[model samples]
Target chain A: MHEFSLCEGIIDAITAQTCQQGFSRVRRVWLEIGALANVELDALRFAFEVVREDTIAASAELDIITLPGRAWCLNCAQTIAVGELYDPCPLCGGYQWRLTGGNEMRIKELEVE
Target chain B: MCATCGCGETEPVIHPHDHAPDHAHPHQHDHAHDTRRISLEQDILAKNAGFAASNRRLFVEQGVLALNLVSSPGSGKTALLSRTVQILRDEFPVAVIGGDQQTANDAERIIAAGAPAVQINTGKGCHLDAHGIGHALERLALPKGGVLFIENVGNLVCPADFDLGEAAKVVILSVTEGEDKPLKYPNMFAAAKLMLLNKTDLLPHVEFDVDRCLDYARRVNRELDILQLSARTGEGMEPWLEWLRRGRHDALIQQINQLEADLAAARSRLIHGGGAIRRTVI
Candidate 1:
């Protein structure tokens, strides 16, 4: 699954940060996931559990913060909430909308000792 | 901020060193816990995206049209690539990178079709990431104003998320598969820019409905480009070849435009009596 690869990405990012931030063990990880990022939370957790072994975040707790998806309606010239990528613009009921936000998965903070 | 870990502490701590030496302090060594909170706003896919960006830059600099071909197993991706390479090799420089779980058979086929090919054995990996593509590109040199076809592992799921710095993702679907495959694997279909319905010769023998299949694909991606071609029998290959030629031509034009802009900038710097004259060679 792509979730497994994405978990690897998270581990890579954490490991790289450890070298720069001089942290050895990660106790907690605060991650921000967008609503339209298409990541299944359960699958991501399962993948993280499988991948976190032998890493600094092995015992870390994952705290996820979800952001709502937003898009810019081209016709109506308004920002509207979008549940999916292919969803029509809520304001004008048109499909010609550009995604403005909520398509990212980022690590916001970490608690380390 | 706490001195030991430099974290923001909400509760006030009693200062032991500020008191008399004989004064007993219970929380004297409490800071030894040394827990720290680090605020790091970092994208999880940054590493992969960085590699992909580098690959894209290299491709653009080299004027190479790199296409990532994705499909399920037995979708005839290798066959399509091999045939396409054979047809285009005389007019352009072509190379292929084959991704598979184990064997190098696809790479061998591409080579047999008369083009340089590198096989990336992913071992247990389900898809070829940008890092793997970077390594493959290092081994295989893509020609200027040519095509570089990256045949991804025979998977429709994991490959959809990983971008290998390709100009476009070309997905292949065979006629033997269900017509509703686009709906079943919407992620893959949605990620692809082009859908090549391969093995059209088998359509007469199979129960595949072309219209329904196209409708399903359109539902997933309304702007997806579709082409019907039988890679084996050389049927409906004209449009595919034309598309490749068009892509290569556009890449060449882009290289030319970039060179012209750089030259103009350098000329302006010289006219302005800059300290040193820097020349860029394409």
Candidate 2:
């Protein structure tokens, strides 16, 4: 599963960060998961918890922020928010809309003390 | 911090050196503490980026032209790669790393078409990553002038996020699938370097719009190389084959030169490490 591997990556990143900063404990972790990233936040969190034990981030709390899918219509020349990716530009009914933002899974920040 | 530990809890033992009287039992207060709000603006994948960059560096040093192919189930990725194996087998030394959920079908197809192929059954995994490819390469025994082709598992959305040490990333879409695929899944298209509109032989009977497919791909990736071809009929394969050959040749020559240099350096290193100048270059 992508979530399982992504959870492994998260654990690796968190481990490397804590080791580098000399922080033996991670208090909180913030992840910015885009709506279009196709990542199930719940599954990812569950995987993270299962794999993060015995690491500095074992006691960490996960905070996720969901970003809405967004795209820019070339004909309309304006960025618009849509429920799905290709919702035919709401302003001009143009199908040729370029995705500008959203659609990614990244950890926003980590709080260590 | 646990309410009782404070990083100094010792099995709730008496502090061996305590000379003062013990305090009364804990109070039964019911006051609720407010939630802690912390500000952190960091990306979770920020760490993987470093390893990805190193993988790219290794790819560049090895001078291998790696291409990661992504597509949906029954999208003809195997067919397209099998076609490439036949076309580029003699033109460019090539190898393939196949990813699938089960069985070595794709790898067998490429091997049957005459090329070195290694199957990576991700089992429950949805995509291929650089580390997996690196591990696969150790078993492939590829030499200089070798072109690496990685066929990711049949998934569009999950494979886009991974950078698998590839020189190019391709998204294969057959006309049998709906025309609204690119519109529906923008991330996969955006991540691809080119989009192969496979099975174009059925264009006449199907409701697929070649122009619409190209337009959608270009809309997402402004520089998307849109190639419309049918792996079955070999229709519209000339340009695709030519482009592939040119790319592989360019990368192979570089690899050959790098290997020669490495051999020379190793000889010189041996000479300087207390050995005579009896270096022989065959």
After the best TM-score superposition of candidate 1, give how far the Cα of residue B57 lies from its true spot, in angstroms.
Answer: 1.1
Sliding window of 10 residues with minimal summed lDDT for model 2 chain B: B5-14
Which candidate comes out best when scored by lDDT?
1
State each candidate's clash count.
0, 6
Tens digit of per-residue lDDT, candidate 2, span B1-282:
233112223221212223443444222224432223334354555544554565556666767677888999999888888987888888767888999989988889899999999999887788887766666776785534557888999988888888876778888999999887887777788778778889999988988877777777765567678888999999988888876777777776766777788999998888787555344432
Query: Which regions in candidate 1 have their CA more than 4 angstroms from the true location?
Result: A35-38, A68-102, B1-30, B34-36, B264-282
lDDT of each: 0.84, 0.74
Q: Residues B1-282, candidate 1: write the lDDT tens digits.
A: 644223235322222234444533233344555778999898888878888988888888888999999999999999999899999999989999999999888899999999999999988888998977877876898777899999999988788878888899999999998888887776688789899999999988999999999987876677899999999999999999999999999888877887788899988878786435433431
DockQ of each model vs. true complex: 0.40, 0.28
lDDT for residue B73 in candidate 2, whole number 0-100 = 93
What's the DockQ of model 2?
Answer: 0.28
Candidate 2: C-alpha RMSD to true structure equals 10.6
Worst 10 residues of 1 chain B by lDDT: B10-19
- The segments of candidate 2 whose C-alpha lies over 4 angstroms from its true place after superposition are A35-38, A53-55, A66-104, B1-43, B46-48, B249-282
